[model samples]
Target: MSGDRGAVELEGVTKRFGSMVAVDSVNLSVKPGEFLSLLGPSGCGKTTTLRMLAGFEQPDSGFIRISGEYVQGVPPYKRDVNTVFQHYALFPHMTVAENVAYGLRQKGVPKSEIAAKVAEALDMVQMSKLAERKPRQMSGGQQQRVAVARALVNRPSVLLLDEPLGALDRKLREEMQIELKLLQSRLGITFIFVTHDQEEAMSMSDRIAIMLDGHIEQLGEPETVYEHPSSAFVAGFIGRNNFWQGVATEHGIRADDGTEFVASRPEEDVPNGQPALAAVRPECINLSAERPADSNNVTAGVVAGVSHFGDVLQYVVSVKDRDLLVLTPRAHAARFQQDDNVFCHWSADDVYLFSARQADIVMTDGDEEIHDN
Candidate 1:
């Protein structure tokens, strides 16, 4: 592995599996030392894209560049990158130190140098104390740390993580997320992480490439993608949203459910009377006992259910034939009970209006799903 700048680039990359295109003609540029995440649902080509970068899968068209060098025919071991898969894939019979040294030994590295590198890698992941433990004897989180250490031992310019923390319990996964981020920052190594979990991507990535149907749907920082999604699919996938199918109007959309929206900041411009989709985030909606005076972006509903999260309250309001999710901070929640009449209102600025091109793909029930384009 070379100590070069870890910038990566993909130019018009495409891959097909028996006529099923896994990665369409896609282009991307990753900056050196940047933590970028490839995020999307299953079959959205995020993993395929990672494989191509790792030299495990070659693109049928286009090309990839790692550390400023073309890697079209490069083998996995020859590439200046290391991959940490969802499964740690550690040698069950080997001690943590031996497992981390396996790659170095295979490459004919001197035993003296390998030991020093292995010790340093284990220390980096805080696994130095457990260097002699076998995989079967250690906890999942501890084993994962060893796996990371093994990858880091080679000193690759770029590290690729494919849902590396997916196997851990929620609390442990969160703990690893913070630890990995801090480690990446300290190492100043470019990390390309692949995960379908939006929260993981949002929390750990400096920028996220939201893939859809073999292409990049949106690429931006966590806040940029969440606050201003490029499409309805991106919006729905990034967070909980209430979507309405309707026709575009001068000011906004008039939903088929008879509710009207006035979006001062519509994401797309749809000509009047054309089909469109309107979206409002759960936290953006406000619930009140009295109807709002404003005419637009307000609807009468009855509280269908209420659930309490640690610091927030979730309310399911039934308006017409649909249920809208509303999230409020516990400190400011009005404490509406089930079956209580309430009004759901949002500001025009809070509404996201887009063309109905993705109407069939948008999950109206607040579920995250990205269908094939």
Candidate 2:
């Protein structure tokens, strides 16, 4: 640690297991006190990358620096970093305070100092009231808070989290997300969080590195990644979109479904007449019973489903053997129903076009992780 609060850098980092390349040529930098996230599907090497940072696993190639200091072979304990895993590995027999104080005692800190730090850490996480309770006596969320306190008790420059909220239910997980983000902001600690959950990463991180098989596909802020995807895979994974297989044309692309799309914002350059793909987000689409006379971007479909999400209404419309997802604000009058004929339309500015190079890859919203390797 270079006396700086927090900073991390990876240069050409690559990790391999036998014949498999877990991570390939990864390069990233995190500012001091920044909250960064490694987000991707399982087997995309996010956990492996975090493990390398924690010193639990070593990289075959590249450099890693913590607070401007190269930590090639420094042990986990010696490095200026702490890890909080999904499972709260607290001692079942020890009280919360005891569990937090164990690290300080192992380092031979004075009993007086350990007591003060333990109290401070527990209070920081709002768990001071449960200091006397054992892990078995606490709720799942409470135990998780204790685990976080235990990690913070060490006061490491950087904190690495691996799906710390994975085991919690939806409501609890969301609540903890807000709490943990606030905690990191208050402490001004550099947090390197690893998660396969897109919404979690989008909600918490200052910047997100979206990974794919052995490599990073894109890196940007949440809004940037969501609004302007760099590739077809990114457009599909960052959120939901209606995709069209097509061939690039002079203005935009001609869809396989016979819908011609003209994107005012084509992110990728493709040769005219070449294979291509176009995508439009559900919120960008409008549904009407009357078909537009214009041919810019319009399609006829039958509403297959309607779902209310409090603030928004989502509809699945089937058109020409393919289903398109559309979202409308709840403030708008609900005008469509299941099996009703509808026309969907979007402006050219709302369309995004991508090269067909990534058309063959199947993107599944990061619901599965490749843990076998």
Give the Cα error of residue 357 in candidate 2, in Å.
2.2
Give RMSD (Å) of candidate 2 vs. truth. Answer: 2.8
In order of appearance, the predictions have TM-scores of 0.96, 0.96
Task: Put down candidate 2 lDDT per residue, 1-373, tens digits, no spaces.
Answer: 4565588999999999999999999999899999999888778998899999999999999999998889999999998999999998999999999999999999999998999999999998999999999999988999999999999998998999999999999999999999999999999999999888889999999999999997989999999999888998888788877788889998898988787888888989878999888888899999988888777898899999999899989999999977888999989875788999999999999999998777766363666211100
Query: Residue 13 in model 1: shift from native, Å?
Result: 0.5
Report lDDT (CA) for all predictions.
0.91, 0.89
Model 2: residues with Cα > 4 Å off, grouped in runs: 1-4, 362-364, 367-373
RMSD of each: 2.1, 2.8
> What does the lDDT come to for candidate 2?
0.89
Positional deviation of residue 100's Cα in model 2 after best superposition, in angstroms = 0.8
Compute the lDDT of residue 254 as modeled in candidate 2.
Answer: 93
- What pairs collide in candidate 1? none
Cα lDDT of model 1 by residue, 248-304, tens digit: 999999998787789899998889999888889999999999878987788999999
